[model samples]
Target chain A: MTVSLRVLDDGAWVSVNDAREVSVSELWRLDDPSFCGCDLPDFVVENVLSVGVDGRTVTANVYGQCIGCGETGVPGWVPVGRLSDGKFVDIDRENTVLPVYDGDDR
Target chain B: MPTDVERWKSEVYGTEIREHLFRFAEEGWDAIPEDERDAWFERFKWWGLYHQRNGQESYFMLRIGTPNGRLEPGQLRVVGEVAKEYATGPGTNPIFGDAYADFTTRQSIQLHWIKLEDVPAIFEKLEAHGLSAQQACGDSWRNIVGNPMAGDDATEVIDAWPVIQELNETFKGNDDHSNLPRKWKVSVTGTPDGSGQGDINDLALEPAYKEIDGEEQVGFNVRVGGGLARNEPRLARDIDVWVAPEDAAAVAGGLSALFRDHGDRENRYNARIKFLVDEWGTEKLRETLQEDYVDFELETAGDDLRDQYTYNAGGEGRNDLLGVHEQKDGSNFVGLNVLVGRMGADDVIQLADLAEQYGSGAARLTQRQNVIVPDIPDGELDDFLAEDLLEHYSPEPSPFMRGSVACTGTEFCSLSIVETKNRQVRFARWLKENVDLPEGVEEFHIHLSGCTASCAQPQIADVSLRGMKTRKDGEPVEALDIGLGGGLGEEPQFARWVTQRVPVDEVPGAIENLLANFDDQRDGTETFREFVLRHDDDELADLVEPEETSYEDPMMHNTKRTWYPYAEDDELDASPAPSLADGTPITSDD
Candidate 1:
């Protein structure tokens, strides 16, 4: 199955075409040094990487700015949501409520 | 300095970090081992480089040291050119737009979105203009702060620019004093109003006069230990020792050396010079300085001109250096507000050009995040006022707009929980549109810090807001706790927390109610800060509290008592009784 992904909300949100077959995890990968410090990196989301899918689980490496010391781009693989029969199941941090896809709330 | 921080400092000083930097530049960021990257980043701070946009590995923020916050027009032009070329902004980014540059509170210029690779070239450009980022950050002495209007102020006790420049020259890149327990902040101000914020610095030199050989000589009265942070917020205390103009640098160097050797290194939080001063007391610290480092015999403080603990001579409000004020030479200096100290590169260049065109080839940055264009001739006043740049960087701003000071919030600071720059600007605009203060109240400082680090110095503002997070309807939202009645100068006081958990959306309305209440209830002579101070916490809370609105509950629909009931007697009997089994009524019987 073909999977489509798009970045939204100024790099704050990500949407996937198939929530069931493709899981979403926040990822951080090494960006090109040339693209480094280019204001905004040339990627779907800078510091986030979508690794290959294993069966139904799509792994991603997440790097986020730390709220404690203002350190950013530190890596940690966070399982944002898993796809189960086309339904998105979010497992991210508490209080991080993901938006429901159109016609999927039911 | 905690163990980790101390280790990092030693590694920074011991290791050939410059060599490693060269290697990283040659091999690229990816080539650096993951374990060493953090250390490299820490070392980079010594060179005035920080990962901007909050630790984004790709981009960096460079801070250039400006001794006394003075910059030549040519130097500023070079900075502007650098911003235009390397810096991003003046575009879609909400925080820092295309070619944006910020005038930091330390009297230095900060440019964001700088690439690691472009930094070498930027440094070269800065050096060519006689500017350097050396020792801008790290544990070493940061920017040596001086009164922005030092030489020009008619009320100035002495010109501190020469002393400030000398100290900067002596300390910048000096390895002997490079590493310390923590960052050391120094301020020197000759203005009687204490515009340089001498009391809030780790080491401050305020103007004083003494009779030496029957001649009244101007000198500096030393102050130590003032700092603002979460747990420790103490005002700097007088050390009772006075240094002549020539010995100011020596005294400063002595104090720095004392702190360097004796300051606490076990805990980073307790490592500031303030902590050492607090521990040993100013008398002991002064004795140590006089005995070991200072070669000359220091005189006791005599006839201090500084307005310590008070805002003005009248002791009413804080000194606001905004608007056009006449210099001692009859020329005028115009202080322009740069909203939260953020300025576009083009605007900076324009300011530099205007300074050269209408006045001396100099622009001064104030601690209040404002800039002053000084030395404008009387004949050039009209031309200066008519300049297009003044429209954006207003000399005369509204109370809310003028007093807004925000730290580099979550937008680029990793330690921040909420975005501060845009939020502060929006909030200021909202207050301007909504709240109307009584006449003669044009300056009220409102500081917002994203976290407890207090980089924005919220503790000293007329009204301070520290960032917080609160849940509203089970959804997390940005909020700020309210602090009121805090100020600097003669009567310096840390702000007291009046209320907490004010949601970002409700801040404007809350402030509107508070100010409206103040306008109505305050005595004709009382300032808003005084009004806040005069009232109890409960009273202050009442002023900012949201208006209570009554709404009919659906659960109480059947239980409602009406003069005329549509229900029949049998239907009325089916309604649940208002009284509990113990005869305690749930609703009022009236």
Candidate 2:
């Protein structure tokens, strides 16, 4: 089954199969220390640059800043959620410490 | 590969989208297929109907494009009546009430909480009054902006209203120029005061004098590819071509075609003609237009009147279209400041009545999100000014109130991260009550744009504020990035982002401190923009001292997650959306 993924409304949100699944303006904690100076990078998503599904693990490349150090740029692909049986499964992204799939590796 | 938006536009777009829009309107909201909802919503923008943000599912934001912001006799009343009757839903704005109209910076009107079912009737009502939303929001020629009182202003170089009308009629419905690579914004300024802010448009026609047929004739010099959006700001570059008033439409059409054919379609981020201009400088752009796009020879650049331009220049003359200005016909045109550009429907109707009673029924909207009532005779000037309606929408308001401009933020727009209009209104009111301007300083512009989309034109103001986020006491809160010293004039400048992320609560205090620092350290009678230009970025940053003051921001939490920021129960699950025509929520069990 094809899970249609899109970044709509001028990069405001990510839609999986025409349903708004993940949106910008949400704060997430990135486990990567290089992303910012804090013990954990406190990331706020300003724009959903693009989205993809790698092995049912949904990843969103976003453009925003870390509140800890005020560093602004695209910080790799942060996992937002996952797809199960071609259906999007929500994760507690705002509460979890997610790992960043660095652009260097991709 | 083309982006999803490009693919959607390629498949079904432009004027043809209207037929399907009406069909879906008649059949109801659910008639649109679930899988195709995104595509249809994207297409609906061509008709000026934008699907409201995530939680508010079925409602739409309807934008009515008034070419040159010109409202004919009695047309103003029609818009007010439309707002009162149809622009209502469950949510009510705390500041603007349930039904109101927003005057946009590009000289257009927007009404929120519009249901798709009522669109056909609304279109009929709007069409009856010579108003439309066609090509208003999509990738086409958005509302043509210029001096609000183009033909009537006594200080204008030449009457450009007829030329604006000709261009509006030529390209508005023409299929040849209706579909472009990205949104095409055009500005035609007949006035030398630069009220149109032509430097920030994709296509600009600024007044000039050219030697044609051995005589000095007044025409317009062409510029292309200026926009402030997506973290990239560019001033429209001079293309070294000039056009007569009669041939303006041809040149505009040709350039629109040039952008349509050559602009990047694959990457939406790199799609604006500004990027294309950045890629192929002005010389090649002009060469391409002369060689392939146009049939006749184009004239070389003419002598421009840049030295006389001072509207919002952070200097003395005509900072904005506020107060009364003399018209050519021994009459006056009053520029009323609509705070944050949002006016209630009752005020709109009363103003329409006042316009017919005291002046010409014709009204116009300025690029600063204000309104102008033209043709008020000398005898009726005192009476018109005395009207109770003018008290709120004052012609001579405080500089803080008049200079405040904001974009539609998290309230109804999807791309905005924070609440804007109400917050700016609060900021302006507090500033008016608390802060005092330095000696000889009257106008202090502070524009608040919710994001880098730059809809509020934040990059060209005395104080610029864009939405951001920060952690306040271990909780995420709304914040703003502060910028200083940007204005348009003989020499235009973009505001430098001095302070990074200041909490929303501290923004007013930050402004107050910045002003105090300028007062303490600046030379006599130096303007804020001048003061900013004197110092480096780090020095300016030090001047912006963000502290907690008595001014409180009610929306400190994340507003984007809510269904409506002002609602009593604003949680996404508490929304009564995806509803039927009668305002009944449609549940899955239904």
Candidate 3:
């Protein structure tokens, strides 16, 4: 119920809240770490698509609309890597595992 | 982030109501458990914030209220930072979509695609910088707007900004107003030439004076109960009271308090301040306001203060914020147009930089979403025009782009009945691509708003579109309710709603037909506004009315002002009282 996921930006760990499904290549391009530091070892990346709010659990739908889109339907999430021109690049990924935490876990 | 959303365009835009949220609210949003409520709030906030920043969605935009439309350099910088940090990523539509720092017609700054989560922080930062976004949303007293070039304009009868600021402070966070039956709008103008929409506010302070014991007192000619929205878009009726500048804020407070105590709350449809005014009449409301004045511990204006401040429209002269103008101090000022008042943060920072670099650190905002950076040297004119920003913001904007206005409709405002932003963009694009408009049409106003609340002031546009919902093929569909022949400034006329509902898909075609009709019947460069006025509804009904007419004739609603033809020198055209010159420093008068 509680999974600690490392933040891609500065490698800081936070609790995952929820996880939703999203594009895989987009997730990789967004700079998702190859190995997420979680409580369990050998946590498969194929099933660990995204980390949700508290960064606790990994679920199939982690990186889907919630984290990326925020709901205004305008994408607020930024990709991990910077573009050649130093501008922010949108991550193009699908079916990626991520860790998520919910308020109940907290 | 792209979805195979071609079939669900409305869903992509989030224009359709969120049934889940509606159901949740109805079942009782307040009844949800605390932790569960937090989950929903965070989720929704995150969703709105994400899409708002992503720039893919419509309607969930953010507006930073610039009261009296003034922005310090630091505050503007934060706005720029927000835009760059959130809305725009590379290769996407710029944060502004097109323009930058849209100087709104009401002297406010509206930025689109703002996330809800970021809003609290930005608001906090703004407050730290002596700025705030209170009353910027919900049905409350919005940013107290006056002329954009308030103190700078030479023709003003009094320095309206000080009085405007006074009223703003009194009501900005007043909880009594925060939960009113409906939103209340107030406008104050010292100029007598009717430069401000005083007649269309819950309370408007126009220029007027009274005689008491042989002494002239400059003060306000009060009007109350005016409002715009769907079924009730009428101008305020006069209350015949004189309020001094010092007492103006308290008067507004008293009036709002009165409305809060007496306004109906059971039925939302009839819950506006105007309805209360309708129920109580001006005389009775004034009496109530006076009684509340004592309870609120407010002061009244003296006789001499009244004589110096009241507006007299017949006193002479008017300025419509047009091209190439001279300042009273032998300098020059030029009005630029910012179409629809949508601007990017980067562009805004650049404009702010330009204002600082090329001229004085002073810029004048206009009621038209444009700005005039004043005190520019004659030598720098060419260099200023050479900049790429000019191409976008239009230092010398055309009539249509210059005067066009569209409020945040279903996109951001929950009260909207249709999508206004996309429609405005679509309509403007269509006109630019297809029409060959004539010249010297310096000032033609086009306003689009969702529903009638008059957020974009459709009642005053040369051509206005108020949102509507109608059944199409037995299904409820979004549409526009078009009005024509409205004009503001000097001589104001409330536009008459001509068509009840025209389907959204058919709006462009309808506009094309209307424009073509205007061109065919033109009498030499007679601005689109004049042309529309010249043609009666009977004439236009031939062009726009559908063949199978599903509803009653809209012309039946056009009965109020049939015989009131245009009059140039009517008694109502008096000039405002003497105002402080533009850009003048604050006085102890308050």
Say which candidate scores most in DockQ.
2
lDDT of 3 at B155: 58
lDDT of 1 at B235: 88
lDDT of each: 0.68, 0.92, 0.51
Better of 2 and 3 by DockQ: 2
lDDT of 2 by residue, B313-372 (tens): 999899889889999998999999999899898889999999999887989998889999
What DockQ does each listed candidate score?
A: 0.02, 0.75, 0.01
Could you give the DockQ of candidate 1? 0.02
lDDT of 2 by residue, A1-106 (tens): 9789999988998999998889888888998787776778888888898998778889999998888898878888888889988888999998999888886654
Superior by DockQ: candidate 1 or candidate 3: 1
Which candidate leads in lDDT?
Answer: 2
Clashes in each model (backbone N, CA, C under 3 Å)?
Answer: 23, 0, 100
Interface RMSD score of candidate 3: 20.2
Steric clash count of candidate 3: 100
Model 3 has a DockQ score of 0.01
Question: Model 3, range A1-106, lDDT digits (tens) per residue?
Answer: 2322222110111112211112121222123322232221111111122233312212232221121221111111222222223222323222223233233532
With a 3 Å backbone cut-off (N, CA, C), the pairs that clash in candidate 2 are none
Off by over 4 Å in 1: A1-106, B14-16, B53-55, B89-91, B308-318, B546-590
